[model samples]
Target: MADTWTAIDFETANQDRGSACAVGLVRVVDGRPVERHSTLIRPPDPVRHFSHHNVAVHGITAADVAHAPAWDAVWRRILDFADGGALVAHNAPFDMGVVRRACAHTGLGHPAIDYACTLALSRRTWRALADHRLPTVCAHIGHRVTRHHRADADAEAAARIMIAAMSEHGTTSLAELSRAAGLRLGRLDAVTAPTPVAAPSPVGPAADRFDHWRRAAETPMPQACPDADPSGPLFGRTVCLSGDLAAMDKPEAWRRVAEAGGHPARNVTRTTDVLVVGSHAGVGKTAKHRRAETYRERGQRIDIITEAELLSRLGMTGA
Candidate 1:
C-alpha cells in the first residue's frame, strides 16, 4: 500500500465552490493517519454570511468563523501539510474545485498537485452497493463516522477507506491502485494563459437544447408532477441544469429531476438548491454558472453536483 497520501475534505459555506468555510485534512504515512488538521475559515467575501440550509448541514454559521483566518492565510499551511504528496478525497472534484476557485478568487496561484477520488475507487472496490456516497461507503467498510459533514472526521474516514481499498486489492502504491481501478489521477496547476472560447453552435432539437424553455409558448411543457416519495433523494430541492449532458436529452433530464421530487430550474440563483453540471460544461465559466458561484460566495447554499452523480442520485445509469 502507498505509504503516504493526503486526504482532504471541505465544507463550503454555500453553493459557490470558493466559499469554503472549513477544511479537514489527514496525512497518512505507512497506511495510517499520523497527522490530522481541521480549521474554520472566513470565506473571501467582505460581508460573509452563512445560509440556514448550509448551517443545518454542517452546523457552521457566520458567527462560528467570524474570527477565523481567511483562505489566503490558511492555504499555505494546507499546502505545506500536503508537502507534494499525492492527494485524495471522497469526492475529489468538489474539494479540488474549492482549492482552485478559492485561489482564483483571492488571486493566488494554485499549487501543482495530483489527486484521486475515493468515490471512484469505491465503485471499483465495492461494486455491489446501490450508492457509493461517502457515508454509505464508509459504513460498508466499517469506518465509524459520527459527523457526516465535518471536515476532519470526513477526511479521516476517507483516509481509512483508501487504506482499506489498497489492502483489499493488494496494491503497493497509489498509482498501482488507481491503475487497477481504471481511474485517472486528476491534476491542478496555475493558469498561465487564457483559453479561446469556441463559437456557439446552432441549437439542436427542442428536446435536446437547454434553452428550449425560452420558447415554452411554442413547445408543450413537461407536466410538473411531484414524486410519490416525499423522502426521495432530491425531495424539496430545486435543481438547475447547466451545459450539454451527453447521456440524455434536456426534456428527459428535466423529467428525471421532477421524478426525484426536485424542481428543474433554467437559471441558477440564490433560491437554486442544486446545480447539475454536465461533462460538456466546458470549464463552467458561463454567465449563469458564474452567477451561481457568486451566490455561493455570498453564503447562499447550493449543491453543485456532476451529471453522473445526479444520475446516481436518481438511481439511473447514463447508459
Candidate 2:
C-alpha cells in the first residue's frame, strides 16, 4: 500500500489457502503509478492444492506450486503489501478473507491496513454499467489487460480502473465510494465502530425535504439525445472515448462513461478499444482510423454514440 490505492489480485486453489498465491500489486500515488510488482508464492499450507477447473482458470497446477513456500513462510512479506497504505481488490471480502485466514493459520503479525473494493466503487460510480468484472470494465474503458483473471494482471488492471473511475466520478474520499459503491461501511464487523453523535437539544417541525426534491424532480431534464437502449452492443468489452467529442462536451461525456463504468480516452490509436464518435468526427479522423485500421487491423471497436444517447444514459430528459 502507498499514498494511493494498492490493488491485489490473488488466484486461489480449490477454495483454500490459495491465500498467498500469485499476486499483482499496483501502487498509485499523486494520481500516477509509482510502483508495480507481480510474483508467485508457495504458501506453507497445501491450501492452493489445485483442481482441474481451477488449473484451467489460472493455468496453475499443483506441480507448479509444489516448490513454492507455504503461507507461513510468506506471511511476513505479504503483510508488507498492506503496510504503507490502503488496499483495493475487486470484491475485498473474498480477498480480505485470504489475508485474514492466512494470518490466522500462520500466526503472522497483521498490519492495520485499510482496504476497499473496486467493485463497490464501480457500482456507486455508475448504476447502469453492464458488469463489474475486471475484463469487462477494462474493455468498456478501452484498456487492454494482457492476462485475464491472473492475480497480478487483474490487480494492476484494477488499479488503473480505480484511478480512471475516481477521475470520472469526481470523487476523492473512500467514504463517498463506499456510500455509492457496494463497499459496506460502518458495520462494526470488519473494523471498530465509530462513536455516536450527541443528540440535539430540541427540535421543531422539519423542513419539507420531500417538497423540495419533488420540485427539483419535476423540472424537465435536458434533451440531448433520443431514448434508445440498443442493447448497447458494449456488454462485455472495454470502451474508451478519444478527442473532442461532437456529441457532448469532454467532461460531461467522460462522466457518462464512468457512470457506465467505462473509461475516457483523450486520443485514439491502434490500441484504442472503442471510439465513441460524435458530430465533429469528420472525414480525416475517420480516414485516419481506417488507414491506421485501428478498429479493423488492431481489433479495436468503434461505437457511434449519438448526442441523444449520451444524454439519455445520464438520466437527462428536458421537455
Candidate 3:
C-alpha cells in the first residue's frame, strides 16, 4: 500500500533459487503502476541448466536466454528500477529467495530491500477462497492474470492485487495494510540459515524429546498404517519433506504421513510421489526440493506442496 513501491517476479531456469532466468518489475506510484521493466537473465554458472518442468512453466528455455545478461550484469538495473521502494510479490519468499541466492552465488551484496507477500495479504483479505494462489486471488479481485507464469504478467497481477487489497481494507499505507492483515513486512536479511535439529544432551527431558525428534527425521522409510484410509489424499503416495515446518517438527510430520498411509522417506528420490515443502518463513527451498523439481523435470509425477496443503491432505486443516 505504499504510494510508491515495486511489484516483482522472477522465473527460474531450474530448481536452484540462484538460477534466475527472467525477472519483471512494476513500479506503482500514488496507487498506480507508472513504470514496468523486465529482463531475461543467464543464470549463474554451474546452476544454469534449464529443467524441462521449469521451461514448461514459463516457456523459457536455455535457448531463450542464451545470450541474455547474467544476474551480476542486470542486478543493478533491477535495483535502480525499484527506486528504493519496497518490493511486493505474489510469493515474496520465492522471489526474494531468488534475489538473495542469486546475489550470494554471484558474489554481489544483498540489496537490503524489504518486501511484502501479496499471497499472504490476499489470504488475510479474502479468507473464503478455497485456495489463495496467484491466479485465483487475481480473479477474485477482477485482475485477470492472462499470462500466469510469465514474470511480467505475474508482477503486474501482483501489483494490481495489492492495490485491490489496499482499497478493500481502506488502508492508505503498507504498514497500515500489513497491520490490518495481521502480518509483517518481510525483509531479505530476515531469512536465516536452516536451523539444524538439536542434538540430545542425554540429561534432561528436553534432550529426550530432541533425541526422539532427531531419530524421527533421520529414520529410514517407515511402514504405513494398515488401518489408514485408502481413499485419503496421501494414501499410497511416497512423501518426502524439505525445510522446517512451523506447524510441527519433522518427526511429527513424518509420523502423520505414515499414519495417513503415505511412505515417509528421508530424502527425495525418483520414486517419491510428493515433496511437502515446509516453511521457515523467508527461507528458500531445500536440496530435497531442488531434487524433486529435477525429478519432475524428468517426467516423474511428484507434487511439491506446501505444509498447509500437506496438512489439508492429511485431514488436519487446523491441527
lDDT of 1 by residue, 161-197 (tens): 9999989898867888878877667677655342322
The TM-score of candidate 3 is 0.64
Q: Could you tally the backbone clashes for each prediction?
A: 1, 22, 0
Candidate 3 has an lDDT of 0.76
Return the TM-score for each candidate structure: 0.64, 0.54, 0.64
Ranking by lDDT: 3, 1, 2
lDDT of each: 0.73, 0.54, 0.76
Encode model 3's per-residue lDDT on 1-319: one tens digit a residue: 3478999999987655678999999999878889999999998875677766567678998889989998987888887898777999875766876787777677677546888888667767887877667877878988888888898999998999999999999986777888887777877664334322222122222336556456665655658865454445677899988876655556556766776678988889878999988754355767888899988888999999988788666543222
Model 1, residue pairs in steric clash: 16-296
Weakest 10 consecutive residues of candidate 2 by summed lDDT: 196-205
When summed lDDT is taken over every stretch of 10 residues in candidate 1, the lowest stretch is 194-203
lDDT of 2 at 117: 64
**How high is the lDDT of residue 223 in model 3?**
82
Q: For model 2, what is the error of residue 266's alpha carbon versus the real structure, in angstroms, after optimal superposition?
A: 51
Report residue 221 deviation for candidate 3 (angstroms): 17
